[model samples]
Target: MSGADIANVCNEAALTAARHNEEYVKLHDFEQAIERVIAGLEKKTKLLSPDEKKVVAYHEAGHAICGWYLEYADPLLKVSIVPRGQGALGYAQYLPADIFLYTTQKLLDRMTMTLGGRVSEELHFNSVTSGASDDFEKVTGLAQRMVLQCGMSPKIGTISYTIDRGQDMTKPYSERTAKTIDSEIRRIVDECHERCKNLLIEKADQVELVAQELLTKEVITREDMIRLLGKRPFANRNDAFDKYLASKDEKGDD
Candidate 1:
């Protein structure tokens, strides 16, 4: 029979089995059925080099550790040293709960965390790698938002003198002001990078251990992370961001 014909036959048989043995149906039947279909279509993918694997491991571990050190970050779900589809050597996954507004301190905290992986590579490996390309993108994007959109920028004051729609993008600001904004962005990024580097340096030992675990097991869980780092630093205060969310959650005045 064709694959579709076979699947239909299997489904009919499973339905018959389910009617007869509901307990067995509840236990393993549905999962096994899906697994069989998935296994039939699976194909092997590319693997990673030893160095690339280590680089990815440390890079992802850096993100996990930094997030673990922050209060508002979601629980770390998984850390994998497995080579994925897009030549990624390792990756970490987290679910962001909510942050209504990005405050100056919170932005810096996030920037510091985002830069952690690259900084860890430098401190522990004595070199940098292309793995940090995505990280730099994230940090730069956050900095731009802070400077241009958020009014967090003291130089521009609280007033937003943004370019109007359909206006010349280049003509939005004078040549001198444009140069100042560029300089300001660089300065902010440098400061955050330095701060992140310092934080990683203090936790250098943890970085090495986490990377080593990733290399050995190919995955690390949240429990493993907590064992490595005691508690997150910002767990206590909401800053402006948390306050805004709380206000939204609360109903209208009493």
Candidate 2:
């Protein structure tokens, strides 16, 4: 199910590999394309110290472990500490659902995963760092969307409010309702963050093991994850991806 955008990236990566005298574009090229699409190209930052790399490794491992346990989360496909994009010391990639309607639990799972890295840094180092700035931004936006757009808030109760930033319409809700919405969003985010922290603490040993692997190997694939963590017990069992995989298996048998 390669979309036009993914195809474009893979083509670009393939062309670059060809220019470099590679006989064929390997799996590595495709992975680079995906990472590039999502996070821009890998940065050429100065090498991190042993301590810094450990912090990053555990941070990313936190995300992967959280995704592993959350049934509604996208599958944790791969993880790396190759210093991709600006300010990202590491990242975990997941296979997301290709649907518009996001369930409350699913959204909550996403926020939990988003905050997992920062929570990990706190747990391991007893302090936080600026590395989780993007995570915080994403978590806040998602939580706000859950409250304002999706009306997943019990307090808001099915009212979708849009701020008319372009001045096309008045801000959709009254000042009091807006305040309530903001409060609800904060509550949602705080709950998700606390839940994520607790999960990381509960699975501390597994987190440490995954980070140790990342330290040994800077990049790891889905198979590597399966081997390292056995299997994700709570992977979402229903999705279009399941049918797609079944079809592929059928085709391969022919």
Candidate 2 residue-wise lDDT, 74-139, digit = tens: 877789998876666788877887768888888899899889898999999967778899889999
**lDDT of the candidates, in the order given:** 0.70, 0.84
lDDT of 2 at 114: 87
Model 2 ranges off by over 4 Å: 1-4, 168-172, 235-249
Give the 10-residue window scoring lowest on summed lDDT in candidate 1. 34-43
Best by lDDT: 2
lDDT tens string, model 1, 1-254? 36895686478548746767764444245433433343231113656778777877888777777777655455565677665545455667554545687668878878878887888788768678888888799989888777777777778656554655575666567788778778878888999888777767777787888888898998786657667665445656534434555797785553
TM-scores of all candidate predictions against the true structure? 0.71, 0.88
Off by over 4 Å in 1: 1-44, 71-74, 161-164, 231-254
The top-ranked prediction according to TM-score is: 2
